[model samples]
Target: MTDAAAGARTTAPILLGVVPFGLVAGVTAVEAGMSPVQAVAMSVVVFAGASQLAAIELVGDTAPVAVIVATALVINLRFVMYSASIAPYLRRLGAPARWVSAYVLTDQAYAVSLAEFRETAPGERSRLWYYLGSALSLWVTWQVATAVGAVAGAAVPAGLSLEFAVPLTFLALLVPAVEDRHTAAVAAVSGVVGVGAAVLPFDLGIVTAGAVGVAVGVALDLRTGAFPVTGDGEPMGDGGRERETDDAAGERGGERR
Candidate 1:
C-alpha cells in the first residue's frame, strides 16, 4: 500500500476516538458563551483539543486573558517534546513544508507517524506523505465533528462519557511504545509524577512530570550506555546514521566532479 493510504488507514480507528472530544469541545465553547464563528475558528486555528478545553473553561470562569494564554501554553508544552522528537525525520523539508508539519503536529499524528518513521528505512521518501495523510485526516474529522457539536449545542448528552476516548487512544499508543525496562520505568515515573503534581498552578503538573521523567531516563541511559550523546549533543545512534549519509553523499559528489 502507498504511504499516504497506509497512514490514513492506520489513523482510522483513532479518528473514532477523537470524534467525541471534538464534539465536546464545540459544545463546550458555545455553552461557554463563544460565538459559533469563534468556536469553530478556535478549532481550526489552535487545533489542540486539550488546550482548547482548558482555555474555554478559563474563559467561562472569567479569567484574565494573560492567565488564559499562559495556561494554554503550559498545557500544550508537550508539543515542544513532540517537535524535537520528529525534527530529524523532517529536517530535509523546506521551510513552508516544515511549518505546515508543525501546525498539524497533534498527538495522534505524532504517535502514528513517529512509530512509522522508526520502523521504516531512514532514507525513505514516503514519511512526509504518510504524516500529511494522517494529519489531514485528523484535521478534517475534527473540524466536521466540532461543527456538528456547535450546531447541536447541549443536545449531545454528557452521560455518553465521550471524554474516555482521549485517554483510551493514548493508552493504546503508549502500550506499544514502551519497549524495554528503561522505557517502562520512565512511563511509570512520568505518570506518577504527573498525577502527584496535579495541584500545581497554571497547569504546570504535566510539564513538570515530563521534565522529571526525561531527566531520569537520560541518567539511566548514561549509566547503561544506551544513548550516548555525541559532541554535538545529538543521540549517537540516529545522529551517526545522519552523519554517515551526509559523508557518503559528499564523497559521491566529489567523485563526479
Candidate 2:
C-alpha cells in the first residue's frame, strides 16, 4: 500500500476513541448554547480535544473569554514538544503545508504518524503523505462525528457516557510506547503523579505529570550513557569515540617521529 493509504488504514482503529470523544465535544458545545456552526468551527479551528472540552466546559460556566483562552493554551503547551519531535519528518514541506499540518496535529496524529514514519524509508515526500493521511483522516472523522452530535443535541445517548473512551484511547497508545524498562518507569511514575495531581485546578496536572515523566526518562537514559541519535542515526554526543580517534592519530604521529 502507498504510504498515505497505509497511514489512513493504521489510523482507522485508533479512531474508536476519537469517535465518542468528538461526539461528546459536539454534544457539550451545543449544551453550552453554541450554535451547531460555532461548535464545528471550534473543532475545525482548535482541533485539540482536551482543550476543546475544557473550553466548552468553561463556556457553559460563563467564564470570561480570557480565562477560557488561557486555559486552552496552557493545556496545549505540550504541543511545543510534539512539534519538536516531529519536525525532522515534516521539515521538508513548504511553509503553507507545515501550517496546515500544524493545524491538524493531534495526539492520535502524532502517535500514528510516528509509528508509520519509523517503518518508512527516509523520503520526505512519503513521510509527509503518511502524516497527512493519518491526520486528515482524524480531521474528517472528528468533524463528521461532532456535527452529528451538535445537530442531534440531546438525541445522543447520555447512557453511553462517552467520556470513558478518551482515557481508554490514550492507554492504547501508551502501551506501545512503553517498550523498555526506562519507559516503563517513566510511565508508572507519570500515571501516579497525574492521578495524584488531578485535584489541581485548570488541568495543570497533565502538564506536571508530563514534565515528571520526561525528567524520569531523561535521567534513566543518561545513567545508561544513552543519548538521542541524529538524522544520520549516529549517537549525538559520543565523546569517547572522538577521543579514541584523536588518540590513534597521536600514536601514529609519535611512531612516525
Candidate 3:
C-alpha cells in the first residue's frame, strides 16, 4: 500500500478508541470538581490523557495545587521519551511544525504513527498525516465524551462501576504494549508495589507504583540489553507478538481486551 493510504487505514482504530477515552476524561474532570466549562477547557488545552486524569484525581482529593501539577508532570514526562523516539522524523519539519506535532502527541497517536512510519517506504512516507488524523480524532472524541460524561456522571450509579473504564482502557493499551520479558517483569514489579502500597493515603500508592514499574522496566531492559543490543545478543521475537497472543487468548476466554 502507498504510505498515504496505509497511514489513513492505520489511524481508524485510534478514532474509535479516543471516543470513549475522551468522554471518560470529560466526565471524570467534572467529578473532580471542575465546572463543565473548565472540564471542557482542559480537553481542549491539554489533550494528554494520563496527565489530565492525574490532575483531576488530585483535585478530587483536595490535594495542594502544586502536588496536583507535579503529578501531572510525572505522568506526562513519558512524552519526552516519545518525542525523542520520533525526533528523527520530525527534525526537518521546522520548529513550529515540530511544536504542533508535539502538542498533539497522545499515546494513541504515537502508537499508530510509529507503526505506520516503520511500515511505509521513504518515498511514500506520511507520518505527519497519520499522527495528525489520529490525534485529531482523539481530541474531538475526548471533548465530546467529557461533555457527555459530565451529564452521565451524575446519573450513572456508583454500583455500576463506570469508574473502572478508564484504567481498563489503560490496561487494554498496556497489555498490547507488553510483548517482552523485560516489560512483563516491570509490570509484575509495579503490581507488587501497588499492592504493597495500597495502605498509603490519598492515592500516593499510584505514584509509587508507577515509579516502581518504570524503574523495574528500565532495570530489566538494561540487564537484558533489550534497549541497545546489537545483532544476535538474543533471538529476535516480534516486539508485539506477546500482545497478539494475549489478545487472542482474551477473545477465546471471554476476557476483556
Candidate 4:
C-alpha cells in the first residue's frame, strides 16, 4: 500500500480504542448525576479523560462545585507541559489552525504527534498531516461515543466495574509507546508515585506524581544533554547515535548498519 494508506490503516485501531473509553466516561458522568447535556459538553469541551473522571468522581459525591472544578483543573495541569512542548511546531500555524489544534489537544494526540515528528524527516510535512489525521479520527470517535453514552447512560448497569476502563485503556495506549529507557523510567516512576499519592485528598496525588515525573525527566535530559543546543539555536545533536558517512565515496556506512 502507499504510505498515506499505510498511515490511515495504522491509525485506525488507535482511533477505535478511543470510542469505548469515551463512552464509558460519558456514561459514568451521567450516572454520577450530571445532566446528559452537561456530560456531553464536558467531553466536547474538556476532552481530557483524567480531568473529566476527577470531576465526575467529585460530582457523584455531591461535592461543592468549586471542589469539582478545582480538582478537574488540577488533573488537567499536565496539558501546560504538552502545550509548551508542541508550541515550536504550531507557532507557524495561523490563528485558526492554532485554535483548532488547541481544542483537539488530548494526551493521545500530543503523544502520537510528537512521536511522528521525531521519527519522520524534518523536510517532510506528511508526518504532521498523518498525526493530525490520526488525532482527528480519534477526536471524532470520542465525540460520537460520548453522545451515545450520554443517551444510553441509564441502560448501563451499576457495579459493572466500568470505572477501571479508563485506566486500562491508558495502559494499553501507553505501554506500547515506551520506546526508550528514559521514557520507561519516567513511566515507572510516575506510576509508583501516582499510586503512592492516591490517598491524598482532592486527587493531589496525581499532580504530585506528575510533578515528580517531569522533574526526573528534565534532570535526566540535562545530565545527558539528550537535546544539544548551539549558539545559533540549532540542535547540534546528542544522546542518539551519530550517522557514519564515507568521506571519499560520499556514501553511508553506519556502525549501526
TM-scores of all candidate predictions against the true structure: 0.87, 0.86, 0.67, 0.79
lDDT minimum window of 10 residues, candidate 3: 228-237
* 1-257: candidate 1 lDDT, tens digit per residue: 37778889999989988898899898899999998788999999999988999999998899999999999999899999888877777766888888999999898999899887766544435778899889989999999988888888889888988778778878877888898899899999999998999999887997999788889988998899775434554334664557768878999999999
Task: Give one digit per residue, the lDDT tens place, for model 4 in 74-173.
Answer: 8778878777776654445667767777777777777766665555434234544555676677777888888888889979776665656667666766
Quote the positional error of residue 71 for candidate 1 in Å.
0.7
Cα RMSD to the true fold for all candidates: 3.5, 5.5, 11.4, 5.5
What's model 1's lDDT at 130?
A: 90
- With candidate 3 superimposed using the best TM-score fit, by how many Å does residue 156's alpha carbon deviate from the native? 3.3
Ranking 1 against 4 by TM-score, winner? 1
| lDDT (Cα atoms) of all candidates against the true structure | 0.85, 0.84, 0.66, 0.71
Each prediction's number of clashing residue pairs: 0, 0, 4, 0
Which numbered prediction scores highest in TM-score against the true structure? 1
lDDT of 2 by residue, 67-122 (tens): 99999998998787778768866666899989988999988889888765654444
Better of 1 and 4 by lDDT: 1
Better structure of 2 and 4 per lDDT: 2
Candidate 2, residue 151: the lDDT equals: 90
Residue 101, model 2: lDDT of 85
